[model samples]
Target: MYLDYFPYPSLRLHQDRMLDAVYDTVSSGDHGIIMIDAPTGTGKTSSISAALAARPGKIVVAVRTVSQIDIYIDEISRIWSKTRHKPEIAYMVGKQKICPLEREFRGESVYAGCARLREWSRNYVSSRIAKGSSSIYDPASDSMPEEEPGYRTFCPHYLKSREGFELNGAVHFRRSGRALDVVESLKKRPISPSQLAESCQGICPYEIMSLYAKDADIVIMNYSHLFSPDFQDIIFQWLEMDSEKVTLIIDEAHNLGDAVRDMNSRILSMRMIDLAETEVEKFEGTLGQARLDESRERASWRREGIRIIRLLLPRLKKFLESKQQRMAEGEALLDADLFRSFIYADLDDIEEALSNFSDVAVAVADLNLAEGDRENLQGEIQPSLALVLLFLNDIERAEKDDSYQSKIAVSGSGGKRQARLEVNNIDPAANIRRITDNINATIMLSGTFSPLEAYELYLLGVENRAKKLSLPNPFPRENRLILGTRKATTQLEVREDADNREEISGHIRSLIE
Candidate 1:
């Protein structure tokens, strides 16, 4: 994994050492994560990236968010300028950030929109051709105009993927000829979400980049992609990446633990139940007896699901509302049978009913149908169903697994004392292992790994399977300075106090001055 074709003329003293450490460990044919900690600006990106690039397989760069994209873009561009091996690079974000059909786009409705676009973009040109042949234009006798459809004229990004560039009178990516003609067209694919939105109209960023990632040498994405089961399935099943051979380069390594926790963390609230109950009431009130009788069975699952939840609520609320004082601690467990039954008997039906309800909700919102029944289906029902489903799934797991601890924490009471039931994986190691089990190796780099032992034991589950490297700060004596201050009480309560806040503000001003 040593860098044979790095663009940089020289690496910093610490960077050089890190580069070698990475190369040695990876080249040793190790099978586990390699953790490295160095102060910021140690050239960690260049060193690790160059090392990974030197190897044969694709480099998967995972960051915490889209805001930090330039790190990879700048590093790769700088490196690519100097190497003949211009690795195909691609990045992806959730559909709300990339899709155009939704109100705010992004992947807000990705589960619905993405499926539509993938099928739409593929058949767009054929649909156009078939439409044109029978109407305004002749198919067999006349050559079709460059854009027979008006949408293609205004939406070039849509057309680029729909109708592949014709090189030598044949479609480029369709039949595989000279890729030269469509190189510029392919470059239009955005590297980030903002760029994607500004790229063009009618273009699905997630769909386009997914295609690019399928053949890419390095696929850059948020750390979230790995944390989500849906995205994990997409990685192996949709993107067709060979999980056993693909290497993982997880940046902001310290945050992975928290990210995993946040990803797995779920809360099903009383407010959701209230909203769901309101929606059901609205459906019944608006539809009336005649219409309700006609379509009641269609949404029978929804009412049954809600009824089951109603049965469990009072019992759950009482248990959660019990004597407890920990701010956000997992204090105790509840009856998992209630959650498990919901999962097995009602979860799937609830999901389908929620989806069916959403279409009706949208119809009501748009005033396309049932104008009198404007509130027939409330928008909150689907999300409520989703949260409830996730909550029940966690509960089901808690019943079966010893590692997971289920708790009911305070979510603020309204009428009859509200609570939030949650299942937290006490040790994230097992879950983290499942994430990387298919991968060949994982490399994690962070500016600080202060509590390395805890991270290894709790987060990675790789205390024995991973290698570690901790280097001293390399800044020179004059370049860095450490300052000390005493008599400052910035504890939580003190910060909340006005007098303490003023004192802290004065100290900060003095320090700055």
Candidate 2:
């Protein structure tokens, strides 16, 4: 079956082994995490496809982003065009990103030559949707693309025990054959809001991952989605159920730790707290008798959170300044940029102060979730908290690292308003272990897992049942060259002189050319 679908001549020995390993791990029913270190040009995608063919349960292949997902999906469709077995693939992206223009294109409504209008359609849609304007939406309802009348594209591939899990390609809607201009299309075939939505099946990364990805073969999302608490519930759910049975690939593994750090951190900012107060004020006149008092209390708490941070930041800044002055005289003992190296030192305290403010702001914003702002609160608070907490936690933890000891400080009095310094050494082992205990298997793969042994040790925290393999670069070595240069090397030092500097510059330019 693979022979017929695969356009390539044959799978290499290592590719076959990788495929078999993945299949065998799934068959064992004990989640397996295999890190295949196949370098670029080694038919990595082909090997992955073959593995999917072997055990086609509800597949969820995640790329780092939606665009990459589109590229891979298109490539797969083109490759599988002649095959008898083809998987039903769906594309999901963020709701914010799926502009109205793109929806029109998918629906085959936006006329050609008006590319500019197509681009702006998303902004139009956002505005209309925000305003609850039904007039503009009415046109979409009038024109509904009829479902295709043909035998659905069905994949012959099947897992041994999964009888009902069939890849039904017909579930997806194809765009219309006709492309019409805005005026003509609107005249001939008005589309309804429901039809527009149906034709536009795009959902955001979180939406796809959390709600729409039940039986998805591939889920395209950001790195943050996998590690962040906002999305960790879903990530854990997937891992806990069949993680060992899954192939969890981190496309950009270099940023994985940073992403994890980002996911873990939280911030509380003055602006955020202020925004909450503003939003809560807007709801003052509309809330119900039942929830009015609770809403008011929440608003007050948000205000209190903001006040605490505002008072804390000025003191934190003065402390850091004093430390900086004291340290300036001790250059032999410490590098000038030692404190400035970490986030806490570099981000003028205002930034960290604002970031921390954002954290409390999130809680404050949540308080504004009165009966009037219910919908806004429902959709916004979680993401806001997720975003703010990441910064807050990062700032607090980064502050704790003894390497940046000069940056640490404490101010403000006790009683729900004290400012205490928080620090983090970020134990990769402990963190990885926590994730591993939650999932079946953890695979950390990247092109440059520098100090590969170090990475292996790091993964040891989560990858107790995993096997690691490294492959050489698949490209010709001669094609890739490495060169190193330093800013202060080779060239003669040019003093801020009149004649000698110009002569040196000309010589450097000649050498460059």
Clashes per model (N, Cα, C within 3 A): 8, 38
Put down candidate 1 lDDT per residue, 1-513, tens digits, no spaces: 345446677767677777776676555444557788878768778754544654446668888767567677767666567655455677866555565544522433434333333334435444554555332221223333454332232223343434333345332334112222333355533244465554433344544666666777778887767775435555565567777667778887887887777666665556544544554455556657675455676866544544555554444444444523343443456557654454345345645544544444443334322212101111111334334445656676776887677776654444333456677766666767776666767778888776667677767765666777776777876887676557557453455688777877887798789
CA displacement after TM-score superposition, residue 478 of candidate 2 (Å): 5.6
Question: TM per model?
Answer: 0.65, 0.52
| Per-residue alpha-carbon lDDT of candidate 2 for residues 97-163, written as tens digits (9 for 90 to 100) | 4433334334222222122232233334334434553323332232223333221121010010011
CA lDDT for candidate 1: 0.56
lDDT of each: 0.56, 0.42
Number of clashes found in candidate 1: 8
